[model samples]
Target: MNKRLLWLLFSILFMAGCSVLSSTDPEFSRENYDSWYDKGEYQKALNHVNERLETYPEDALLWNEKGYILISMEQYNEALQPLEKAIELNAELDSAYNNKALAYNETGEYEQAIVAAQKAIDLSEEEPEQFINMGNALSFLERDEKALEYFNKALAIDANAPYAQYGKGVSLYFLGKYEEGIPYFENYLHSYPNDIDALWYLVYSYDTLGDYMETIPYLNQIIDNQKENPINTVDYKGLMLTYAGELEEATTIYDGIIEQYPNEAIGYYGKGVLQIQQGQTDNGLQSLEQAVALDNSLKETAYNDPLLSSVYNDELFKRIVE
Candidate 1:
């Protein structure tokens, strides 16, 4: 062959090789989706997995990955079929069943989640997550004692498992053993300090045990962290004044709560009561107005609260709460 013709042939071969090595190509053999998935960039991961699935539709691992991603996205109903298909393709794939359990759990199908989690436990290579899934399902079904067994099993497998600790704590909590639940909750919180759910669980447990002072700090943390908190901060203020008698500390906590969650009425309501107790009459009244402006329900609260008796007839207070 002529030199020019040989060079053109080499260029064509190299271009074809590079084309075949792209990430989407089934023959390319890269774990590209893992990076996206691990980084919590699910959409990018899904797109990448979908590209591979287009070429290798029967791949069990890819289908399982797809199902898990959908679950993580909270599309539980959508995740089911892919997970089922993964199981169909590879009956022994324990992780697929585990993923299915999580999806079913989210959909409130506790019985089905238990069934899938059991299969995962049977097939998994002693994975603590499998037991934790089983425990969560049982707990959701209100069978906390039975859930405790599974959570303990998970703990047996991995002593430092955060999910297992949380599960054990929740089971103990539902069983009315608040004191026993405390340590496990603390253990879980050690791993996930910002988890609102765990923090709330700890607060409720402390409140039930009459550990009013202990509840205050967690309540403050929840108010600062939770965007749509369901907790009644006004009631928390009452607990602070009535049970804790740490008015100064409570006032400072409420101040931080107000600063951290400026738009929430509860924080302002809490701070208002604290200010009134300290005899900052004008500041207290202003806080009350702000509270009622944010949530009209606080008006009724302010009017009924004993702590506001002296201010009940104050014109600004009457206009604010009444």
Candidate 2:
């Protein structure tokens, strides 16, 4: 699935505080199950649901709950079974259809996701989730204009809908209306100030407009977040700095990356590009040679980039890329 969907799932699972769902039996309580689910105890929640299902075998709600928990755990394939069962047991379960759409979307079954979301919308036109789901499916299918329409429909129903706001921004960005997409991402960031997804779009939109300086704050936010979780390897901050003509700051970032990850070729590549752009042809060529030696895959990129044109016909540059 796309990063948009992943961000939505994380927001739902973490931000939607433990609200208890209605249960048929007093014995099959939500208290214990909700506590487990809220604490990221998927296995415990699954066990509880399995035990309850034995006594309440026909409970469509229980099956749906199980499916929802499974989706939260990212067990999309496993989630389908319970969600499908919930629909079979009670065809009118609109929420079950929505959950099913979520599972299908996660698995890249966009057509099935659209069908399930349409079913949910048919069952309950008042809910914004169905529209958001449909929009997300359309976005993934590259029907960005159609996706924007659904997102607008959801926004008409609830102006403050975070998913709708985020969807509108994403759809507009995908449609190449990057300038128009900025406000929607800003609105989303108002609700979720530190959300990496919204910040990423802000960075991208500004960068696309050739206003790389405008991307700094958002890039800093992402850089700060990466400190908390370092799996992110992309040097967006450095790239933005280079684009904005902040060569010193960009070089510092590249230097840090090389110090931290000595063998990674991208750091050297970025440093080389920056150096060449700043007219240090000899030093840049040396760095580029080191980068190519580490990873020859970047040779084509280095050869074609306009910023390196000054040395395009240079003997050393030709040797490095060729």
Candidate 1: which pairs clash?
none
Give Cα-based local distance difference scores for all models: 0.74, 0.81
RMSD of 1: 14.5
Best by lDDT: 2
Counting only residues 3 or more apart in sequence or on different chains, how many pairs clash (N, Cα, C under 3 Å) in candidate 2?
A: 0
lDDT tens readout by residue for model 1, 1-322: 1211111111100000001112223543334645665577879877877887888888877777788778766677998999899789878878788887777777778799899988887776377877877787788778989999998998998899887898898889889998998899899889878776777777777777877878867876777776765356545744555456688766766776777778988888887877887789899898888999999998888989887888888999989865
Write down the TM-score of every candidate.
0.70, 0.84
What would you estimate as the lDDT of candidate 2? 0.81
Residue 261 of model 2 has an lDDT of: 85
- Give the 10-residue window scoring lowest on summed lDDT in candidate 1: 10-19
In model 2, the runs with Cα more than 4 Å from the true position are 1-23, 27-36, 227-234
Given candidate 2, what's the lDDT at residue 224? 72
